[model samples]
Target chain A: MDEAVSATAGARVPRTERGRRTLRLILDAAAAEFGERGFHEAGISRITQRAGVALGTFYTYFDSKEAVFTALVRDMSMQVRDHVAPRLSGTADAIAAEGAGLEAFIGFARAHKEIYRIIDEAEFVDQASFRTHYQSTVDRIVTRLRRGAARGEVREDIGEVHGWAIVGMNVFLGLRYGVWNEDGAPEEIAGTVNAMLRDGLKP
Target chain B: MDEAVSATAGARVPRTERGRRTLRLILDAAAAEFGERGFHEAGISRITQRAGVALGTFYTYFDSKEAVFTALVRDMSMQVRDHVAPRLSGTADAIAAEGAGLEAFIGFARAHKEIYRIIDEAEFVDQASFRTHYQSTVDRIVTRLRRGAARGEVREDIGEVHGWAIVGMNVFLGLRYGVWNEDGAPEEIAGTVNAMLRDGLKP
Candidate 1:
């Protein structure tokens, strides 16, 4: 099981600027390695080599490859939310609102396809990490929906159930569009998903 | 890319009694192994050993673990259709029809949790295979929905959009309830899903 770190833990203060830079180097290297080779295939030694850090220094921050992956998951989560947060605030009509959310979500997915892949494979690599990240994403979306509902920006009919519905739809789209690249471009698929959400899957 | 079937020609006869028996043995063993260790962890040797077959004999039926997984995916698809066919034929009411479809889908998922894992992991293992299976499942469900709409047993507004929506919902529920055992039993989750489907996701 992947251990959950306090939000600040992954970015814990370094004794020096050099220490901070080294931590970023390690994480960036770890992310690249994991993205290319997958969680199981990416080893600690390789990650250290990629970061140009001492093997012993790697242990100072992360317990193992699983820990690095967990930190990466958390980092990606923050990145995704940061990317979408701006667009999500200050929306217009229902159609525009839905469109903005879908676009923002899909845009983030498009830009960070590797992060999505790593998170997707986390299910097979470690169930705890998968659930943690999955639930956190869902919960974040649900919170947004709740906020919309409160503001009377969303249809009263669409409630928590609708949250799950949107989550389900977006999840499949993310898997198909980014992880699998099953069909059309991420933007094009995002349009279809937005249409379905607004029109109730009617023609 | 994993081979869908072994290169050896006529290694296992299709539709012949002996071939059918061998295929059944291979499929059953694959399912069990996949259930116990997931797709990546389960090996072809373990499956063949459990099935009381030699290594070469295993390849005679399946080119690799993936080939066996492909066969299992196909078989599960057929089983799902069989389970839903009777319900589709019996229902005339739109809400009732949707409920029946949701229940039948969940029932199939519960009964074949291992197969569901293989299908889900297809995202990670082989995107091409994942898309092939995904499109096939979507087409089948869309056909049924179109039939229901023609009979006035489903909302006329529904189309491929709803097809995608329903498929997305089922996949999410199956992963959460059936595969991961996240919160509730499959049957209970099925009821919640059916209700959401029959009625709109309004408050």
Candidate 2:
């Protein structure tokens, strides 16, 4: 987990602020390349060109195309966490926080629609990263659910299974409402799902 | 959708029972090849070898590798439906049927571990098939939910969003419980999710 901060998988850790900026540039460029062209067609030189950096600079942070894609997957995972964390912090009730988290995620997904393609493609491009990404996300949800349980905001016996279900619901809701089509406003969509979470779908 | 019965993504329809058996063998072999080696590295000859058919026989059905992969995705979708649908029909209570469906799905996923990889790869190999697989699955869920609503087993307003949310939950649960770890029994996992779905997660 500590390694996640400085580097992802085999990516080299940047030593300075400028170096970090260069790594970020490379990752952003890689996202666009991989997201649009996919892993097989996406090339290192094209990623470098898109990043507006030299090929040597890419080697400074990542050893190969696979390395950068792995790093990008990790970066996106963190990006999603960072984006939704603050919004959750502002919420007190666990259920309310879940709703807020979902709305914020929908907003994030809409803004970075390529996240879906990139993450889904990780299955073929880098299988380990793909597994890690989902495992980590579900772990985060389990932690939050346990925390909510301790505070009596959620069911006392809720555990990993519940976390997986919520994560799945949020992921699909994001896909349908955020990535595929913006059928409803993010808050509205979140509210609808939250209602179902708050009450059973019983008539 | 007419072509879906005989072919997937421009594949030729088989005319005879023998032809259907051959097509079935090819699809099963394609699933094995694509599921294990993925779309790019999975070769036609390998599929033919696995199916005990000649290369000409492979061509008699599928026009290309992409076509077979696409067909496999659709086939898996049907496989999932066929596996779960009968189980659902045996249960009278719609809510209870969903739990049965989930448990059956977890079992299917456990048995067909490569299913996750192959279906996920469809997003990259054939976008249309990928979309169709999920769209059709969610539609089936929507129809079931509406039927439940009519029977007063589910809420009347339970519609597409609920269907998508439930699909997402079931998919992720299958990934974790069935594919990744199998920490809990399918019945246990389904029971837990069904409970959350049956009642709100309120403390």
Candidate 3:
């Protein structure tokens, strides 16, 4: 079971390893169900069926469809954070880390194409979760940029505006290059963006 | 009626000045209805009421609730483009133009806070309009960047990727600084981002 899945406040915490496995199954199933059918159309029965669990088993973890959807949004948000964190740690500088982070993100988006749908849907379904997902993501970027500034790799005044800019850039890039089509390699796309980030668009 | 409102394929174009006013009233009413209540909860009757028109008058322009929603999305898209085009044209160079454009967008977003909700909801209610809105916006940015490149103001290789990045940055900035809060002045926010775009983040 992923650490991210365990943090969902909407889900009841599992007590044992077996229970954890069951919870994992339900979450993954929820992702597929919500990703395809959306909030209004998705059902708990279909989710349990996809998870290969009984209806009672799903009730043990989540009380309602909305609860599960909320949990799933948190889980996916953490999933993205976890996936990109390690890549950032391995890079040489702030700018290079951004390049690596974007490459990892685009790859993640390609693998979890439903992520966009789920996150975007949260805006209407669970507004708080949607806002938190982006706020936290931007906060993380600010922390990273600040760290880079302390290390003398980034501008000393690096702050929230830059963080939001980078996150937005990565997101739309993921939407276009990762989910919409695969015409550009993730590395090439990241490289182009990194070059722009490292040096402005000016000639 | 605004030129943007006239281009909507879902709504029938008005044949006379009075007809155009009626259509304009319907479209504006739809924006408020869809923006406030969303697609599923919004109703055609409610739209006509808001427009101060009879139910029969709505059918004269729009066939259904979905038709008006689709038209509203396209109208808002063009609204943003039309609002920013002149700002871009008046600037000294591509970079400066982006600053002006971002400032204009943030101001527009502040005035029309519901624009975000309406456009974002289009993702779920009308996928084609949502995608077309972003694609057309990005295409315009790409064209501007190419023109800048030709004049040696922007990098020669600037294309769709850079276009998407700028649009994404402007959008998130508008959401944060425009709709979410007015803590930062539009000029200051745009200037900060413009500096980043004018020069890399390196110390």
Per-model TM-score of chain A alone?
A: 0.79, 0.94, 0.94
Fnat, model by model in order, equals: 0.18, 0.82, 0.59
Give the higher-DockQ candidate: 1 or 3: 3
The CA lDDT at B115 in model 2 is 98
Off by over 4 Å in 1: A1-18, A52-54, A93-99, A151-161, A179-192, A198-203, B1-11, B53-56, B93-98, B146-162, B182-203
Residue pairs of candidate 1 with colliding backbone atoms? A157-B202
Q: Compute the lDDT of residue A160 as modeled in candidate 2.
A: 78
Error of 2 at A159 (Å): 1.0
- lDDT value, residue B83 of candidate 3: 95
lDDT of each: 0.65, 0.84, 0.86
lDDT of 2 by residue, B52-147 (tens): 999999999888887788778888888899999888986867777889999999999999999999998877778788888888889998888778
Alpha-carbon interface RMSD for all candidates, in angstroms = 4.0, 2.5, 2.5
Deviation (Å) of A186 in candidate 1 = 6.1
- lDDT by residue (tens digit), candidate 1, B1-203: 22323211223445567766776787788778886788778999999888877888787776677777766766655666677768766664555555676666766766777766676676667666567667766777777666656776555555454566667777766666555564554445555555555544221
True contact recovery of candidate 2:
0.82
Standalone chain B TM-score for every prediction? 0.78, 0.93, 0.94
Q: Write the per-residue lDDT of candidate 2 for residues A42-85, one digit (tens) a residue.
A: 99999999999998988887778888888898889889999999
Maximum-DockQ candidate: 2
Ranking of models by lDDT: 3, 2, 1
lDDT per residue, candidate 1, A24-80, as tens digits? 898888878988888767899999999998999998887777777877777776667
